[model samples]
Target: MTSRSSWNTRNSDVAWAKFDPIAYVDHNYRCIQEDDAEILRIVRDHFADHFRTTDTTGPVSGIDVGSGPNLYPALAMLPWCEEITLLEYSPANVRYLEGQVMSYDANWDQFWDVLREHEAYRSLGMGPRDRFCRAVEVKEGDLFDLARHEGR
Candidate 1:
């Protein structure tokens, strides 16, 4: 089993320690530009209810467990949750996610466009990338250490 501190140290043994953020985006996120209609449909269906109401009863907070350098999955949760806690095991990935939030990257445009293509999201007429950066909060934590990460 992976120890709690194993990823904390970012040991070379950890496969994710060598993760490449730009390459990851190029490989995964750019697919949205290719064809995101189906993706938008699925995610929109999952999160459509969250946008129907403007009250506090809706999902107020959500967590991205083991979030790597990927941002699309978090984008999928954007409409449903007000605050998204990005829990990452690798320090490298944590820093990467934090950097993206601190400064929105232009490369993510395709991903945002894909999300915005949905009628529900398109109606917002707002910048999805900017909104995503604002809503996300990065936290470094262990995925296996149930005691510490359970209620976070």
Candidate 2:
């Protein structure tokens, strides 16, 4: 099988940076709500049943491979995860995500209110999502670097 690194290197500059979360939510609201909710529920339940109980550690570490502009997986895993590393090869997307995080203002209740309408906020607890946003560490590299660092 070809390694993830090989794929990442080949498509490092793929233009996933153009994705807009708000536009995506507006276009595919129902599917995003339903599919994402189901997937997140399954993941949460699985982790809660297997890893959470099995591991003595309070929180588990996870990685979001090929994390794009949408950080859904990292947000979903926040309830049970301690740290989440978002690996993205595109410098543009990395900068965009960083900008979103940095520009988020607690005083802008209207923006938040509009965002809360999306089921993503409800299914994944708002607090947990915020925690995940803070916990997420965006790294510029391929999967091979991650494997090497983790000693996988």
Candidate 3:
């Protein structure tokens, strides 16, 4: 029988890890869903509006904590960031993200389709693999273990 952590998972992140990153990515992201497309648009638009007037004299760093097998979040920050971090807890997920970042899976192209609809995203004017591989960094880490950062 498979064991599960019994600790109160409601208010905390304490738990045992279990998931198949390959299966998860294939099932959820391999085929672009309506929900995922909507989310990509929402994130893209939100970021577009948020940074519209801000004077970002330099490229900023971005991080997605407990990012799992998802790459859309990191994609949303692609234009504005010089470097991005995908911090995941699962070992399998870390490996998956590493490969995906280095040699970005083609499945994510649909997600980029939505992102490119935005002015900032399209303004990038470069291929996704070149831009993404240049900017993304994958690290194995849990959410609760993070140290305080200056940003919100």
Candidate 4:
């Protein structure tokens, strides 16, 4: 079997985002079904329990590594984390994330509904899109460069 890495190396420059940003958004994040809501609820419930007794007032930070234009994972961290740094390699994805922060797709509202159910988030006064945008910071960088080791 051919290695996936070799195949990706041969086709890495394909302009997935350059072709059409809106279409990309439409295909990926715009579709929200009941299954997605259930998954979001599971994640929210887990984190809500994890941070229940934890002090949320402190400067808690989280890094969403390789955050390929997805916002829900960062939203999941909001119960405890005050600052979320979204590190991604794709410039197009970075722009997409920034745009979503300013004005999110309507589908994201369902995920927020799950998050808002948590009292921890409610106590923080983080109502919705604006608060989520304020919490996120996008940085462009490769995950490999972030490895903590001398040779890595």
Candidate 5:
């Protein structure tokens, strides 16, 4: 049997072509339906507090290290953040994330629903897409690159 990694690499192009962020969200939501509310609450609270005192006026940026198929954290951080740069080493994962932001089929309503209901996230912006597009960037790289740039 082909390993997951090999399968992903072999079919990266096709997989990415059919990728849908809304479906991705729905899948994950179903998978974690029990924990969704708690997880989002914690994430939203943490970032809201983190960004509260931080300088958001001058292009605040964050790196989502090792972001896999999960975009919850990155999406959660969008409201209080000015820019988010995602770092995923796998080409397949990168392609998946890119598809999430670039070619999501469903309206961002459901995604926004999660964010809007959370206390911290609700205060960040009017909705998901509005918050998402404000200052988000995705790149194919790793955390080491982020650290290297910060050290400079």
Candidate 6:
């Protein structure tokens, strides 16, 4: 069989650009399911444990590759990062993310509620949407391109 790369030479967005960001949000993130909650707790604890010991002179920056319509990743990292880049390849997702950062939809509050079960997230205080909007920026990028430079 031909290599997958040869068959998919076109830009990644060629297909993903058709993805519906809002529909995805409605379907997956409208509520925090049990599995999502467990995963969020695991990730929050992991990041908190790592960052708690990380020696930093100043603010920390983070990146969430292929962030898509997911806000939970950014929310989990919100406490630790001064700035979080939500990198995505889909044009539809890029627009949706930009819009949310401008004025986040309230549906995300439930996700924040779950994250705050940990002290690290609770310390950030109320108004998670506003806080998240302030720290996050949406960017259109290719994860594969970044992978090409995995090592110096």
In model 5, what is the error at residue 84, expressed in angstroms? Answer: 0.6
- Per-residue lDDT tens digits for candidate 6, residues 16-117, read 878898889889988768899888878988988898898878887888999999888898888878899999999889988888896677877787887888
Worst 10 residues of 2 by lDDT: 104-113
- Evaluate all candidate structures by whole-model CA lDDT and list the values in order: 0.72, 0.58, 0.83, 0.74, 0.64, 0.84
Ranking by TM-score: 3, 6, 4, 1, 5, 2
Best-performing candidate as measured by lDDT: 6
User: How far is 100's C-alpha from truth in model 5 (Å)?
Assistant: 1.7
Our tally of clashes for model 1 stands at 0
C-alpha TM-score for every candidate: 0.70, 0.60, 0.85, 0.74, 0.64, 0.82
Query: Listing every candidate in turn, what is its Cα RMSD in Å to the true structure after a full C-alpha superposition?
Result: 5.9, 7.2, 3.9, 4.2, 6.1, 4.1
After superposition of all CA atoms, the RMSD between model 3 and the true structure is 3.9
Evaluate model 5: give its TM-score. Answer: 0.64
Best by TM-score: 3
| TM-score, cand. 1 vs. native | 0.70
Among all windows of 10 consecutive residues in model 4, the one with the lowest summed lDDT is: 10-19
Better of 4 and 6 by TM-score: 6
Please write out the lDDT profile of model 4 over residues 1-152, one tens digit for every residue.
98987687633465534545467557866776677678887888777776765556658888898787788888888656768988877788888777877667787776777667767667766466767777889888777678763452
Ranking by lDDT: 6, 3, 4, 1, 5, 2
lDDT of 2 by residue, 119-144 (tens): 54445545643675667787866765
| Model 2 score (lDDT) | 0.58
